[model samples]
Target: MRRSGQNRFPEVDALRGCAVVMMLLYHMLFDLVFFGNLKMNLFSPFWRGYVLSGASLFVGLAGLSLTLSFSRERKHRNVVPFSKYLKRGLLLLFYGMVITLVTYLALPESYVRFGVLHCIGTSVILAYPFIPRPWLSLLGGLGSIVAGYFLSLKIFPFSFLLFLGLKPPRFSTLDYFPLFPWFGVVLLGIFAGNFLYPGGERGFTLPNIPAFPFRGLAFLGRHSLTIYLFHQPVILGLLFLLGLIRFPL
Candidate 1:
């Protein structure tokens, strides 16, 4: 969360920071595999579950924050505006496109065509109409989960529906999160946000932590997008340099 208004939620920021930390740990293991320093089944059931958990947390947080935004607007004004959500979603989509280009150039074989960024961006746009109706969003989210589970079993002729969880039998990507089950997680977050934090304000009190670790996590959460874009390059570069010391590329 970027501060769009005066109101701030420390709990949300902390939770997001926790997600970021979890993502970094997972990516570090992935980088180790890429660097030939470790050999583990990346696509193993355990790893897949790990990835799903992290992604769910991240996407769910996005939905929660969106609800908070709407609530904040409604508090200040009589209505909530879709323009702000649309603007942010489009910006995220553009960034996702840039990532697609970079990844295709860097690692064409396993490029990200419809990664988490794309899913989140598209989900935000699609979720706008349902923001006002928390119960409906909840039901839709559950339905998506059931639908996506079955959809994943089937294969499409083309990769165009990759964003929608449809793809060819052999299609694969380094990062892929279709708007099926994942979007359902976001919708659940919206429901939780509305239920827990009505009107974008805390429903219960949280004790103050006068500690630096918590503050550092909050900072990381606030600037997650910047970190996500650069962390891979940084990790890869360091690993490559380390590998050169003992083995030839």
Candidate 2:
């Protein structure tokens, strides 16, 4: 999704593609376990860290991309509108809601109420004010992380606030990413983007190397959202065809 007249950053796209690969691996493992084809503890420390790392890469890149877009837009138009972010956020949220609906019908006991899409969408909208202020973004990001640590220690009774890092005891979900700590990752990415790509131009130098090696990953990154929406179904279908999983009658 390159903006008009904006420089394309293949590195960013490749990194995002790498994260997408990680996500695909994680989901494949999860499906294997869920279908009784594998016996592993996904909640173990190692797996938890794996999940966090992948999510951080995705969310952080989102923030960084937002800053780059904002910088370019500001340069071109002399003013960046909030409506761009609003429309994008709403689109992602709508996609998240569609996932929620599908999951609710497929697995009512554990549907994704607020998954990565929801978090990223909400963060995109929330991070707009801090886009031009790197220092404030750093502070806000760190503060959110600290606050999330404390917030996770207690359980709130209200289910309506689940997206805000508050939840009742035993609240189970297949995928969950609340704002607190996760939003911090996005802010940090914003800070990094502003610092690294000031005025929408690269602030550092790199050797002029060919992009051939990264072509595949960059392609994956460019179409990440579409892949994310369809990968699970494809995986499940393959597993079913191989007799690795069975659909409930």
Candidate 3:
């Protein structure tokens, strides 16, 4: 039931590309504030909503992409191996650990302990059972979201559980996306993926839109992981070169 000779979905990639643009803009503003050039409040209502929306787009897309991958694999093998997900998840987690190390060295006070990469990696592993069950995924996703709300209300003393949405009092991070709500978002994406792209085929009609306009965005989306890994450094370097920020000698 796959699309004829088309392995990738341009629409999905374009949407992900849009999210990447949003992320870049948000991080640029955040870096400005970090460098003392801006006094804006990112925790304010507008910025908070913006951040949440951008994160949702990324996480949800990851979930949807998982379903497509699973279906595609199923076509080739009788039993999809858990090792496939395991390896992928571990690779992402490894990348996340690298970020953790870099940020800890650079900004120990508010370093990322378990950011979006960690969350996505863990979600990919945990979501294996839920991919084929849309109804269960829906319930699980909503439950996780509700549970996250409750978890955020209380602060625990244990720092080890930070990845699971438990926070110590006064905990701060430049980036953080624990499993509860964010993983729930992934599950919801999985649910939507199953419903919208059952057996890796589009369930709805899409217009024959021109590819030229979307080519750039699609390219960005395809290389999003690399962009995410490098964007901050590039942005900071640009700011430094522009004389907007000076190195502390």
Candidate 4:
């Protein structure tokens, strides 16, 4: 659409933006429940699917983009390219730590352990080589969900595997993606991306955009990384400063 090298897929970016938007909404809702202002039991097994779904969408897109990043028609690698991915991953790890620090400072008893960003970030680095393979990625991604589901129903030293989205247990982290299942989703995306866009001048067909809104979604998509890292903090700050927090401290 915008020349080969500068070939930006509006659809993918839009999807990432959408994921970020959903993430904010989900996290915000959780905050409400955590503060006890909301009536819903956000963590009930019946409703937990909603949280996992948002995570699935986000990771699926990450897989999809892995393919886009290597389009042959495209030039100009990312600013730091692979390193940037690594850096983003580490940044998330650090952010997770910082969250623990803040929570420990505030609500020490229920601090966040392994949130989505940490899972996503860890996957980014681990997902590199796998991006080149499709079948493997699919198996791994779907495997995560299956594993987590089954693992959650049991209890044993082996049960902790599910929290990693592999084996399963009753124990829950503040936000857990577990390397097993989430990585599988990412792998599935990689597989899709590879099958769709296998590099070179003539790779991957772009579908026709039929009347979908574009510019705004594209901007959100482009800035999704920044949005993910900051949206909640900004919103939480706003709530705190505005005295809208009703957690009944």
Candidate 5:
């Protein structure tokens, strides 16, 4: 997944590839249900675990990538600039907003209010200030995890803070990844990246593996954002052509 002219960590891209594969499988199952080709509860423990684990992997990898990028920039320039991160985060947020509009138009009853893209973008922006302070970032991450856990146990009257993991009464969403616990995961990744990678270079050498199959996976991982943006529509379109685009509505 290393760009031709940029610094990259191959292992990170491979891990991202793994996460994306899992995500694709999960979404395929979801589409099967949407098209009445499956009759299983997606909220079942197996599905829930699968989804959460994949999300965690992706978020953690994102944090790791941030640290690497920051380190590379800092090496060339004495100070790390915030503009690049801000631009990328806002761009992702815009894409998330597009998803929201599309879902609202297509499936208003269960549209995405705040999904993975929103969480990642928001987390990147919010976590930027803490990246330079690994210890503080660790504490913040732990705190968010604990706070979100307890918060999830209680319900609120309003839904405004749903992005923060505050559950509102009778609320439902197609996808939700609140900042509380999930951002904490990102922080933890930052902590790990700082501790392990130190200056963004691996502390230890890794054996060079053949790039035949792994490179193929890395390609998918590198373009994951673009793939995510279009995969659902592609899946649905294929299903529609196969006479499987059934919906209760």
Candidate 6:
């Protein structure tokens, strides 16, 4: 399975690419409506609920990829480059911090205290020591999600874990993905990574799934961390400039 030097898993990349594309499209629409460039029927409860599933796809795929990247294979280094992985995870957290600062400066009302990207990056670091054990990661991930569900009630006084999914009495944020259940998802990735190997080498180019979607989506997924931070701001800025130029009403 695992050979030597420059290990490449195009299938996982493609999967991630798919996730990223879906996310980008969703965010594009979300950004458009958010900045008032256009209106969406998200005002309806059903529509709002439907859109929420978009996050699930992003998160679930994130988990899957996280595991895939870190799992051990023959001679290709021990279960995902720990040092590099940790470094990458920290970088993601650093970027998340930058976003938090920007949000505080721009939109304190909807600042991202513990958003998905933040959670994913941080969870990756937190998940490092535990990747070797599959069952433990599974239990941890499941427990985290379940715990998050319970904690959302906001009964406990642990404000810190609020980011862990403990809902503050009237809390609200534009982006939020706490440590508990969210970390569980990453752990799910770890578990899946440990167990599954996409049978036969070569990687990616699944015949059943069409090529265009696969290419665009995989591209998005590969650059997800970068895209996640920048997409909204770019969309919002373009909308603003467009509004100023044409629809100055």
In order, the Cα lDDT scores of the candidates are 0.83, 0.88, 0.90, 0.67, 0.85, 0.68
Which lDDT tens digits does candidate 6 get at residues 1-249?
232135545556666666666666766677667655566775488656654565666666566655555543424753456676688788888888898889887778878888877887888778877667779988988898888887766566456766667665657677788887778878887677666643224333345556666656556667777787788777667867877222223
- lDDT by residue (tens digit), candidate 3, 39-147: 8898899999998898899899999999999999989998888888889999999999999999999989999899999999999999999988899999999999999
Model 4 lDDT per residue over 1-249, tens place: 433126666667777777777778777777766653667776688557866676777888877776666553245653325675688679878876777677667766555566666677788888866665677777777777687667556566654344375433345445566676677787888877777666623265656664456556667888887786677678777776776666454
Task: Give lDDT for model 1.
Answer: 0.83
Tell me each candidate's TM-score.
0.91, 0.94, 0.95, 0.75, 0.93, 0.79
Off by over 4 Å in 6: 1-6, 37-52, 71-82, 155-158, 198-208, 244-249
Model 1 stretches with alpha carbons more than 4 Å out: 1-5, 207-212, 244-249
Per-residue lDDT tens digits of candidate 1, residues 46-159? Answer: 988988887888899998988888987897888778888889889889989999999998788889999888888888888997787899989999998888899899988888
Model 1 — TM-score against the truth? 0.91
Native RMSD of candidate 2 (Å):
2.4
C-alpha root-mean-square deviation, each candidate: 2.8, 2.4, 2.1, 4.3, 2.0, 4.2
Better-scoring candidate (TM-score), 2 or 4? 2
Question: Which lDDT tens digits does candidate 5 get at residues 137-175?
Answer: 899999998988998899999888999999888877888
Alpha-carbon shift of residue 30 in model 6 (angstroms):
2.9
Flag the better candidate by TM-score, 3 or 6. Answer: 3
Ranking by lDDT: 3, 2, 5, 1, 6, 4
RMSD of 6: 4.2
- What RMSD does model 1 have? 2.8
Query: Model 1: how far is 144 from its true place, Å?
Result: 1.0
Model 4 weakest lDDT span, ten residues long: 72-81
Q: Number of backbone collisions per candidate, in order?
A: 0, 0, 0, 15, 0, 8
Which of the predicted structures, 1 or 2, would earn the higher TM-score when compared with the native? 2
On TM-score, the candidate that comes out on top is 3
lDDT winner among the candidates? 3
